[model samples]
Target: MKSLDRKFTLWALAWPIFMELFLQTLLGTVDTLSVSQISDGAVAVVGLSNHLFSAMMTLFMVVASGAGILIAQRIGSQREEDARSLAMLSLKVCGVIGLVLSVFLYTQPGLIAQWLNVPEALIPLAESYIAIAGAGMVFTALSAVLGTALRSTGNTKAPMVVGVVINIVHVALNYAFIFGAFGFPEWGLAGVAVSTLVSKLLGTAILYFIFIEAFHRRIGWKELARYWDRSLLKEVLHIGWPLGINMSAWVLTQLVIYVFLATLGVKELAAKTYMNTLESFCFTLGYAVALALQIQVAHLFGAGRTRDAYKATYKALWIGLAVVTVNALLLFSLGRQLLGIFTDDAQVIAIGISLLGLNLILQPGKMLNMALTNALNAVGDTRYTMVISFVCMWLVATGGSYVLGLHWGWGIVGVYICMIADEYIRGILCLYRWRGQKYLRQAEAEPALGVGLSAREQELVQA
Candidate 1:
């Protein structure tokens, strides 16, 4: 492969990730809009159920994240063969976890609904939706790891294509099943779940094929057995365990916030859901840049170029902030018009507009937090992020939301303030760590891949 300049490579990778995220976000928005047409209560049910789905995705992160870091580092170190092995390992691990969680969540749908404090009227709707959507958890898990693996190898476009396919399939199926169009049965919430599951399953299959090609057909039985090395598992877990814990903690914090919001009323719940979906449109840009930064930072760190890693992070942060700022401005300007697509409720649109205005204030801090945290994690500063996140999220954000939103009767506005506070706090800390040399110590703890690539890989590199 030819070596590309850092700046060119960064955007080359970031754009596809951005589009993939946008399409995925759009997918959820369509689901919300379709269900919104049925009833606001149904919209609330789908929204809350999807939040639970996000929390459940923590399991996929555990394996996908660990494997992703290692894969990037291995590619950086020019250990292509080992990277292939790690990709295969990540897929197997995520697939198994997905299967188990799918069964667990699907069978205990009511449990999940109850856990979220779904209203009595909405409980059945949420349960029925989650029960069917829960099976897609497996596809989600596998697709996440597969996409990450491909991205680690700098094949981000493949995942973007797969996402396009998912969007197309999901929208078509949703239209047909949602209203019984073209002779299809009207399944309502269940129909929405079917669209999600079928699209994810198909997308997962596509990603699997792409992973096989990207990794040089490395998923065969003999190759899988060969790649399942105990040491690789240990290395992956070393990096992924902290990330998974951190992600789970964050998910729990969000769920707690949702619990607080749910107490307000279903209208608040629906508003929060719309806010989240729309917020994704802006945050996706920041997250895309951050994710690209992670791969670049990991590659630099793997090559022992710590200073370049820092430079890459700062550069990515600037780009992320700019993109996010533009997105925020667009969202702020058109918040009402855009939100009105999901529902005709003037009140919901008003609340959502206010939330988007708050998001403009939230964007810069969020951009920094997203970029720097991912850069920190890429270089093995995972534990610091995990610990600080746990502390700030629960102590500051979670606790503040309850005191401000519920206790003070400030409602969703109070929760947004808490969220903004946490983002800035974490963002400042991450910035401090990036600017200083304290995080360098963690680099010494990274996995060693010896001096150079194998002769076969070396020959391929020379060729």
Candidate 2:
């Protein structure tokens, strides 16, 4: 009865999701800031390794993302049992996927660094950092899956609370290990990686405790024992594979752009690293809104409130665009001060400032894509979004970055210009698809579960 417990409006849902994502992004920024003290080369190598890990992180989402959607719809349809089963199933699947990716990262760190074409001088540090940090992928995967389950229930606050703890501990560990503070050895990059691994492990454990305590309370471990569900797993994969691939394509495209920057030199890569950290603040606004919107829309769709679901995404999209416009402007105005916090190098500061300026135009387009693609996914329209992402990311972003930045010698500036084009191109296509409203036609495929006392309870607890 307590399984599908919470109701959410956009703001109620989004702010906590924003805080959680902000904390996660801050963790990455904190790592870069700490390593910036060592050398620009250190920042560059660590960034490369992080990109590789991130690309693999998308693979974990293949299961978590799909399962989250399934759980949300099932709960909306009043299928409490199915919703709980999907949550357990996601944890098992993500754990296995995470373990496999972890081993790959640990064993092939050097090879991946080479594939990224990182400078020879940076490869050794990158390899070591990757192995240590990558070994913890399982913890992150578990944390993510647990968070996905909670979010589907509209309980964003739990994950946000856990994130706050993870960030604090990670910062303290980084200081002790990176600088010999608290009598810890100054392990530098290795210390940073270890701190990350420890924090993620703690996050996973806490999230698991919360999951069992909150959702599986009556049954507890007995509920956890209800794991395998191949037919359900297939349904999740049916919805998720395109999404996972789409997510990977986006991250890989960003990494490819970084690779182009790496070809220019470590300075360029370091500059972009700072740029990315700063840019994360802008994207988080839209991403948080989009995620919250997806949960709300899925519930609405499952309840057969088709018109309300359609209106929700559009309403949220405009609001997201306005907020990000302000965020991007504020970030650009304080660009020098922010870049200064990361490094003392004037060139890096100058280059980072330039990217921040371009982001004024870039942020809106990115918001558009996040808002629409997520809304589309909420209605089970995954394949169309995936195809557009594949086309726009590679042909427009990747190829253009190479031709403009490398071949044309226009440098990071040209690469960024092309990047802006990629975002808008995808944004426009997403707009067109959402307008078509084919999702309405597909709604009958996933009808609601039979109504009961629990469904009446949910109706009484309105958003």
Q: What is the C-alpha RMSD of each candidate to the true structure, in Å?
A: 4.2, 4.8
lDDT of 1 by residue, 1-463 (tens): 2354453378888999999998988998888888888899998888777768878899779878988987887888777888888888888888888999899888999988888898998888888898999888999898999899899888889999998999999999999998999899999888999988999999988887777778654467667655666667777888888899889889889888988888998788889988888888988988999999998888777666676777778889998899899999999998888888888888888788778879998988889888989999987778989988999999889999999999998999999999999999999998888788665554444324332233344456557
Would you give me the overall lDDT of model 1? 0.84
Segments in model 2 whose C-alpha atoms lie over 4 Å from true places: 1-6, 216-219, 222-226, 444-463
Write candidate 2's Cα lDDT for 1-463 as tens digits: 1122246678888999999999999998999999998899999988887887789899889999998887877777777677887888888889989999889888888788889898989888888898899999999799999999999977889999999999999999999999999989999989999999999999999999888654543436765665687877887898899999899998999888888888898889999988989999988978899999999888776666667788888899999999999999999899899899999999989889878879999999999988999999887899998999999899989999999999999999998888899888888898899888887655543333322113333345542
Question: Which residue pairs overlap in candidate 2's backbone?
Answer: none
**For this target, which candidate reaches the highest lDDT against the unseen true structure?**
2
